[model samples]
Target: MTQESSRTPPVQDQAAPVSGEGAQAFTRAQVEELFLNAAREGDADLLTRFLAAGMDPNLRAEKGYTPLILATYNGHAQAAAVLLAHGAQPDLQDEKGATALAGVAFKGDVALARQLLDAGASVDVPNAVGRTPLMFAVMFGREPMARLLLEAGASPTLRDGEGLSAVDLAQRQGNTALAQDIRHAAQG
Candidate 1:
């Protein structure tokens, strides 16, 4: 058997003291792992269990990605909605200062983006590099996402750290169609 398969599971013996400090700490770690894993794997049921068990809705993984951000990055709309329902802040940024909306824009998940907007996420928030969600959407040719962000008040005129607006970035990326769309949105 593989080493992982050969390992024994933790005992749930009620006869033993559940309140032991070591046991309690181990259980807490396990619960945290479960919460992080649930977010990464898009396991809504496990996420619900952890949240109901008092796990923080805003808990971040080792890489600083919150449960909502993880779910949004993974395109787990249901899991993301669950996190939002449990008081998770939609605008919380990860280590890179990119929020869940940015991940949704990168992944071209219009539904997730809509959910984030409904939850009051800011469309104009920039990442560490000053690239807003609209810039990401345009650069990545996520036309629908670009439109959504525009509707949500993403400033196409806002420049990134490179001093390029979403239109300029889109044109530089050879996304002429997206550039045109951005221009139209800006003029309207």
Candidate 2:
């Protein structure tokens, strides 16, 4: 396979290459953990290699964090891009039901969030707590992230499980200016 090939068979569809004839077989869980670790460490090359080797790009860790989620949480844009190119599902939620977009929002990473959006990630998918990416941004005082999410069509009127909108969360967090800005954007 060429170095640029992004799509590959799922891990179960292919046999992992062994270094030698007598080498012990690696379980699927071990491979998944390796993939997740590579994502968390920002090792784009390792991710590429894994994908090339037919390891599933969408594998989740013990906490249900996909490679894309781990990469975004660690600010590894390159790794994220690699995962996306390899068909990683950006909307898959972790244990907390937080998508990769939410991770970027918490990190205040507009660029990473943009990458996810461009790859068809939903801007309005909420976590287990019903907190959308916009709410996460607002709660964390991530103005740029909130702005980007708004521009990408995040619903400002959507409320969390607690029935608090992003603007309300912003206000509760003492971000008056950002709350006003979000309110205006929501209204406009």
Candidate 3:
């Protein structure tokens, strides 16, 4: 009996090569803990192993932090990349309703924000306080990130739950330059 000749499948379609009996010994909770730690430590290799083992890239840890949330918030670009590539949900909010983009915004990470945007993160995802990424950037004086978000279609006039817009936050934060920039962008 002849079998089908094409045994080689796409690498990602298969469970990645895991070695040793120890690989099978972890309990689900242990695996969960490892994913969270890997995200926090920026361990891309360990992250890949878990992802290839069919772990949910969006699995939430304590305080409802997903691997993507933890990785990006910690400024782990490579780990965040891996998570996004493995199908992490860019819009998943934590228990506090903060999206990964919202967290990255306050950090002044323009490149990381671009990455998140490229990965389909919404530019205007509001948190529990109804603050969008643009508001966070403006309030934190991340002028460049705020500009990037505006160029990406974040509404400068968007009001948070506290009835403050990005411009309002920028002014309140004492960043007149950013407020001017935001106003100009809005008018244009």
- Sequence-dependent TM-score of model 1: 0.84
lDDT string for model 2 (127-180, tens) is 998999999999888899999999999999999999999989988999989889
User: Model 1: which residue pairs collide?
Assistant: none
TM-score of 2: 0.85
Cα RMSD for predicted model 2: 4.7
Score candidate 1 by lDDT.
Answer: 0.83
Tens digits of per-residue lDDT for model 3 on 12-124?
A: 22234333533223445665777789898899987887788678999989898999989999999999999999999999999989999998999989988999999999999
lDDT of each: 0.83, 0.86, 0.85
Query: Model 1, residue 40: displacement in angstroms?
Result: 1.1
TM-score of each: 0.84, 0.85, 0.86
Q: Which sections of candidate 3 miss by over 4 Å?
A: 1-24
Residue pairs that clash (backbone atoms under 3 angstroms), model 3: none
1 or 2, which is superior by lDDT? 2
